[model samples]
Target chain A: MYNKQYLNFLSGLILLFLSHSLMANVITIEITGTPFNPIKIAVVPFQWQGQNLPPAEIASIITSDLYRSGRFNPIKETELTSKPVKGSEIVFADWEKLDVDYVVVGQLNQRNSKYEIRFELFDVFRGEQLSGYNIPSRTKQLRNNAHVISDIIYEKITGQKGDFATQVAYVTAIKKQKQLQYSLHIADSDGYNAQQIVISDEPLLSPAWSPDASKIAYVSYEDHRPLVYIQETATGKKKKVISFFKGINGAPAWSPDGKKLALTLSQGDNPDIYIIDLANNSRTRLTKSFAIDTEPAWSPDGRFIIFTSDRGGKPQLYRVPSIGGRIQRLTFDGEYNARASYSPNGQNIVMVRGEGGKFQIAVLDLGTGFLRILTPGNLDESPSFSPNGNMIIYATENQGKGILAAVSLDGSVHQRLKLQQGSVREPVWAPYGRSR
Target chain B: MNQIKLLSTGLCVLVLSGCGLFGEKVEETDITEETTQTQQQTTPSQETTQPTGQQVQPQTNNVTTNNNGNTGQQSNNAVTQGLGNRPNTQLNEIKEPITPPTERTIYFDFDKSLVRSDMQNILAKHALYLSENPRATIVLEGHADERGTREYNLALGERRARAVKQVLILQGAYADQIEMVSYGEEKPVSLSHDDESWALNRRVEFVYQGQ
Candidate 1:
């Protein structure tokens, strides 16, 4: 009797899987790594008990998020023998037979006007619930809530925090009537619901997120000059922070403490890195070199500032004390390297590495002093690490138009985030939550 | 001396006619005629008075004399000199056309900001023009090919512009008359991704104000 029932359940799962695959026009991730095998897991579709359908699909978001990390291979929903919406309903034997190591089940309940999501993650081998969460969110915030659940499940299993709930800020360039229109945009890590934070006809470059993720600092070329501005991400209000300089005032990088910005200022000579205190507006020169020194990125600990300098005759990564002291060269592999950003843990640095005639994204391990090339594009640049340090997003050209692309740090997973009618660039991943 | 004069006048006519093909639209015919006439009068004295090795000295003197005679017409001659050829003979004579400047772009090597040896004479011409015209101003717009980081490219562009500015300053161009702005790789004269297009894009352009 149980064998006949299992056959019937398998057929039903096959039908549901075909239906879901046909209906969902999801942004699929293209993973490319042969040496590493991803963990197998199953994310069951959440039960919808609310009066109206949810704004975002919770299970699919978690599935894509986990799959994009290149660490988890989410099982097809149709492969499940039974649809479990809670921990009590989960059948470990069925999941074990399907070869999935873990399973995620959830239920979305509406309490008056608010929505609550209760999710349970189970270890199919152990046949026990590993973790659970009841997250309350608004209808519009359901996508973020789903990401939060993915984060919880990911951390519980992998022992590393997931950056699914974080945001990515990038610049988009649209050619309109013989002129390029540039805009700064902030979107979810999965590249959904992108909102323009600032727009101008002039070119916008080098966007840096503050520690709290409440503000973004970028370089804007308005009034025929490059000026740095700090704008609140939520309100869209901005203030010109460094416009009075005669020469270049650009590459604003927020310090870890959010008290200052390390920037590049030429002042009619060779450009050098400088740190500007946001409180009193006092500027301190960092590197005194005749070679070009720019693109300053602060360490996560705020103890050192890594910047791009061509003092060795080619653009390479260098580090200096935050308060200004001896400068040390960091990168020695490639002929050209620049725009280095520290990983969240500060163990590795992601940067644009140019070799032969092509530029691609690469990472430098600080401890091992080895460089790993992560991209295979001719013109890839502006690499920013996800807050969890799992993925690196950067700008690359496709058919002569700029588009954003993300790759797993190990180069196992790759995904492209493209706009419908314009080019995107300079993607900077926002920091984790404010509480961190 | 007469043969040299006749040869120089003939050469001047050939150069001016060539300039008429690419000279500024407003000064096309006038520049050709005025430059031919000035060369007829100035060439004989310049060629006869100067030693063979000092050809550039007489040419520079003749350009200044023509400027004193008719500034507008002589400026047109300077423009013709800039547009005619590579100035293999008289570098200073080709350099004096400040008001109606013709040679604007200065090209550079890949990832380099130093003023090329070939561009030095052209830059000197612009410098002499700016020095002669005190009220005149020009913006040195620097650019780079689509390679490397944008911010560093901006600085590289500035470095190229500053290199030109240094040459101009050394050649007596006023500090206030020259303003430098690095467009980096934002503006490209050629959009293709090749060596020729990149070479065209990696340049500093002299944009004269109130021209």
Candidate 2:
């Protein structure tokens, strides 16, 4: 009896140790959407004329990107009656019979180290090419060329710029034994090819991308204190931009022009919003209130700085001039609304709204003052708008582990991105530009 | 063995008399010394409070010898005995534990920073200890429940820390002795999403330096 009890206790200890070491691996993105009359389109598989197969399938990538947008329903390649590599080789009658409104056809040719990618968007009804582009890129740039092609096709069809070519930065945390490992990662907007920009044994939070998408600023607690650091995305080189502050050096948001960063500092009695000029590290205090004020996001035009403040009791969104002037309260609908970022066009603002003890993502129309809740999850935060203002990516919890999630502005499309083992959070969508 | 018994009996008598004399001296001296001595007394007494089975036999013998010798110190013995015997009981009743820093975690209500009545005595104990130990320093790590945005929570955590700092400074702790850092909701002791877990997460943890 004594031996059995001892064995049971030993097994219990082993199980406990095993459970603590378990962690998720690479993140897998799960896309779910309720299509609301999605437009019918066909993306023909691009013919590869290279000796080595291109790194990634160009047509398939474009098809997945369009389908995930919740605006287009690309027919499967197996369902295609004929595959056309160019507009002149298209059979418009077959597509018309298939009820397809648009078709994308492309071909990839390799000339030594350079790749010649040609793609065209065709009007299936008119039997004519609506748009065509010949993009010349290196072998390694094939995937990016695919995204750019997807963007062009999306723009030609929807009249809105596509965010496929953009990237996202987020923080991932994994518990190993008694230590917590944190990594800041930058990946394509589709959550592929993630590269760790910074990794530490301590916690990392609040990653903010620069407007040009070349640099990222985030808070690191490696020294057991919160300090802001900016890193070049392409080179993975970082510098401690703001440290040695008495209290917090957090919430770093790059201005629209990328020359200045608006952040929250608490060297004084209370936390307040402050903008630091990147050139000289000179700071200009924006809010002068005893209440907590933080999460400063700049307007697209760089005219106003919107932030979250609890000056009026509960935390709400507030706006002030970039150069420090009158402060105006911007949100009044909810008891808790914060972490707001502007859409690329500056017509709407997406923020995390808390009501009935559940926090979710919501968008407030600036012109109409209409608030629309975009997510159904209970604990959603860090809402960042895609560069083209078509989708909002945020962090949400699943089974007590943090996960990255994105929702279309209209709330029609939803995608959950999660690592196989660990937790990821604080996703910031990079702006549209040619950076990597 | 007879001599040991007699010495213990005599030590108890000395402790009782010492308590009487030391209580009077505490009233005469300033607040810092009184609290500092009280905290110094607590360290040895806490060791004795632990289960005797877990204590090494030699260590316990050493403690007994130290106690016998300390009893001969008169007023200091009285203060030490008073603190060791009762811990923070009297201080809790008085709501001013000008004795020692015993509490480490200061909890707050959801989205609120006003230190609750139950936590006042604990904060008072910390304040008294800090006020007494001039060279001693502490870091107040403030945290918040995972209900709001990250940046806003960061500010909230700082507010809670500042609230604790204000209480400590008001109670005589040196302004420079306490450093505050807010971790917001990034680090949580409890990972559960329920109210109980959140209450545990929203707290100010007092970490002493050179421990």
Candidate 3:
């Protein structure tokens, strides 16, 4: 759905989101569509030319990445009649009999302490090699390199940018007897290589990545009140953005330029939206309603900001100018809509739609005013767009537990990354690059 | 790969008694206002029609004498004799027989900030206890169920707590004596996913600081 130029330009604004609180909630999945005509692909196990083996299962990683995208269904490793290391070895008749449309073949070898990874994508029907890469890498970079391979093969076939190389940050919690342990974690998009960023006895929510991917801004209750804190991803150091306030101080959204944050501060017995300029420590109040006005997200273009407010009775999505002006209602299809944000293209808004207490992720096209409900689950929230505007990641509750789930924009592809023991929610997909 | 262990930052209990701002220690809030004029105007709740307001707060010396643990103390509870039963400062100290209500929690409906009507009596009882004991401070831990988004739930939790706080202040409790912190949907009393469990988790808890 996104091009390379757009992905490169959109790399900075990967919408950083949250993980499920450590509830250990297993993913509740319905196992929906497969893109109508699913692409049948085969990634043969890579040939190892070095002693022992490479740190990663390169072929399996690429296979899993494509399958997770819900676009390609890679054949099982057991189904491969012959393992091919190059284009000439691939027997097109064998793949045609098996009905695989595309094939990925690769070899890995140690060259002067650097792992040389070579791979080629082939259109089995045309019997032509579509793409190939000869890359030089190191030991630790192998896993990431596998994802890099996945991106190339995925893009070659789907004609869209791949998000496998991107990172995701979410908050997870594990209960230790009488105490609830909370920790913020960042992991690969596939729910692997998770690294904990911060831990507190209190709750942490709404993690926003800096445009540069160097820092994350989240709300923590460690000080016994919800206050916004910006933490350096490289360091555990953090400082409260606001000195102290009498009431609620939560919901932090970084501006596209990263110089400002639109926040929700409850001062006069009600919550309202305020923009804080980081340079001079100045604050701009956007919405001054007695109703609950919260969950502020700036548009990708930074021209406007969308928020959830109950000024219209039930909570609904409202759009206002970024500099503060006349407000307009965006969604009337649902009785309850909140935690809304813009797609990287700024043409659509993803939000949590609730009616009759059953909530799920929904998307509203900015041009047509048509609301398309994505997830079918009753309890789903915190919908965030991948930087390329291809997939939307959110948290959903299954059975009695919380887990992370993602659905493509067209509601065709659904993937659940509930591999962790505890439940995870509030998953925000990182943009094009790695997190610092 | 540079994963820093934050146990030390969380273990700041050794350095700072309370988790105030980051290196910004907050002085104890000043909640002692001794004027008692608008008792009739504020909090015209159905359960507690007559609120004595500041006049009901007992003095420091008499508060020490009333142990309030006696089984007989339950007989003079908040609804009956405790609701403006002993008026003014003189009788408040001697007749302040109502022990702090054992039930300290008040639950709210889904996404609702207003405390339920049935829970009003519990808050009234707690307000009466606060009115009688001005020296004692309680922190209201606001919480929401794990149904909604975290940040929105955080805001909702605070609204529920502040709703109770406003009621307490209107009834008789000093504003400064009650502190609030919303855990949002982060901390759940019930881990189950059904309505009963979510109902149990959405509440405000009365946590008295120090003995």
Candidate 4:
């Protein structure tokens, strides 16, 4: 009888150990990474309804896009016993057995030199297509169309809007001894279909997109010095919009209304805060200190501008009225804080802060003043919020090479968007979200 | 004479005991000689001194001067921290022998405007020299980085001259000489983002033009 009692106790202890181990693994997978909730998505390959293959690879592109987002688990084609190529052919039993919650299917057709892409979103359990659309496209617009489809699927499944159709403006450098080649490129946020909008053998830095996403303003070395240029997005055409005065021409921040810009200028002897009107082209100086001031960002309401200044000794964030009034300092914890971007909600600000000689992205609550570092990388900078403010894109170094990276606003997940070849730097997130 | 002789005898005894002091002095001399020889043997080509924090100060300045033209170029990696939004201001301090002025004079047009082509040459030279020197830093004071809104012109003025600097480095300038700083027509070289004033105001000038 005593022997039977001891055996029972041992069996209970063994069962507890196994259960504890399984639970720990599950908790670590979700807790350590992004806000990923283990979403199950069925990505059916796009079928070409046209006689010839489309100019773009639609399914591969969408697969790459969703996979890179870190929010979904796209089922693999090899794992399935059978696959469906179109919405009409889908078998819900096959998807259900694979434990997929959502299914995507699409077809491509070309007519009269224009392409039409039809895609459908479906709920696996309901066995019904949830949403479907047919959109016109051009050969040049195929990849962009794929981005749009991905955006739609993402919003429908995640309940948050997507920014896949947005344009990312960045600088690329090719250096050979004393010669440096700099090009300003605008492309899909995934770094596809990138076209060189402005190419200078000089240094190009700081590319800012307009609120309407129709234009890009950037610093170029065309005149052998740092000058600002505005370029139309549709055409590569450009004009010198601003030039030298004093100190340095750096850090251009556009207002929410697309009417004015907040920039750093040293023409007044010190790099101070200033505002310029795009209509009459006039100036109103806001700051009068001798400290180094730069990197301005506007609130969504367009009433205030946040900027970086060393007035308090180290670089910190400060806010001033857009109409030129009293300035209030915002950040105080770290010795250095600069390059701040406002979230879509305008309740928080994302910026690069230095701690222990390394730089990382940090979000500051405008309401509570709570600051939290977002990334662990040493050189993260230029944090830009997504349209919904759920994700942030910034510049960081990987293995000593400069590339753009994205992370969840809550610091739960990390993803990298690197160039297939060469070096890429300076990523500017689009304001109007992605293109249609 | 007997008392004097007794006192002199006592003094001799005292003097004899002082011989221990001489022996100690000899020992110290032997140690000094040995140390000097060991130092000479170890460092026969140059004199040596214990290096402290103060010793590095003058050497650091000398090394910086020796690298005068290249020091700024070497630190170009620092600007990588800008990732995408930060400006490459480190290039400005590379080769600039002259001190930058607190203010600059950018020219503009009246009523009708654009960044004049003539200004390109000056801006190019500033960018080229600044980037090459990497240490000769200058701020491209943008009267407009553009001239749309107060905020828009702020971005425009910064863009106008930065566009120039981008071109300059392409023409073989260093990243050092030119910094993109927009005054947004506030301290207008011509006081406008207007066609005329905008033309002039939409300019960036070297802070230390003459220098």
Clashes of each: 1, 8, 15, 134
Residue A96 C-alpha lDDT in model 1: 82
- Tens-place lDDT per residue, model 1, A1-436, is 9999999988887776565544333333344443168889999998887653554578988988888788898988778789989888887888888899999998888888888888999999999999998988786688888888889988999999988988999998878888888899988887775788888988888899999999999888887878899999878899998777888998999988899999999998889999999998999999888999999998889999999999999999899999888899888777999999999999999999999999999988899988899899998999999998999999888777778888989988888875666877889899885622
Off by over 4 Å in 4: A1-35, A49-54, A109-115, A433-436, B1-211
Residue A10, candidate 4: how far off, in angstroms? 73
Q: Which stretches of candidate 3 lie over 4 Å from their true place?
A: A1-33, A78-81, A91-101, A111-114, A125-127, A433-436, B1-99
Q: Candidate 4's residue-wise lDDT over A91-114, tens digit each?
A: 889888889898888878878778
Decide which is better by DockQ, 1 or 4: 1
Q: Residue by residue across A1-436, what tens digits does model 3's lDDT show?
A: 4698788655533321112222212232334457645799999999988754455578988987777677777888999898899999999999999999999999998887789889999999999999999888886677778898888887888788877878888988777778877788887777666888989888788888877667788988787777889998887788888855767777888898889989988863688999999898799999998788899999988989999988987788898998999999887777788899999889999998888778889999988988899998988988888777878888887665567888878888887766546667678777664432
Q: What does chain B score (TM) in every candidate?
A: 0.54, 0.54, 0.54, 0.39
Q: Whole-model Cα lDDT per candidate?
A: 0.82, 0.83, 0.78, 0.66
Model 2 C-alpha lDDT per residue in residues B63-101, reported as the tens digit of each score? 112122233134644543443232221210112323346
List the DockQ of the predictions in order: 0.47, 0.53, 0.36, 0.03
- TM-score of the first chain in candidate 2 relative to the native first chain: 0.88
i-RMS for every candidate? 0.9, 1.1, 1.6, 12.9
Q: Candidate 1 — which residues are off by over 4 angstroms?
A: A1-37, A48-54, A108-116, A134-137, B1-99, B117-124, B190-192
Give model 3's TM-score versus the native structure. Answer: 0.77
Candidate 3 chain A weakest lDDT stretch, 10 residues: A15-24
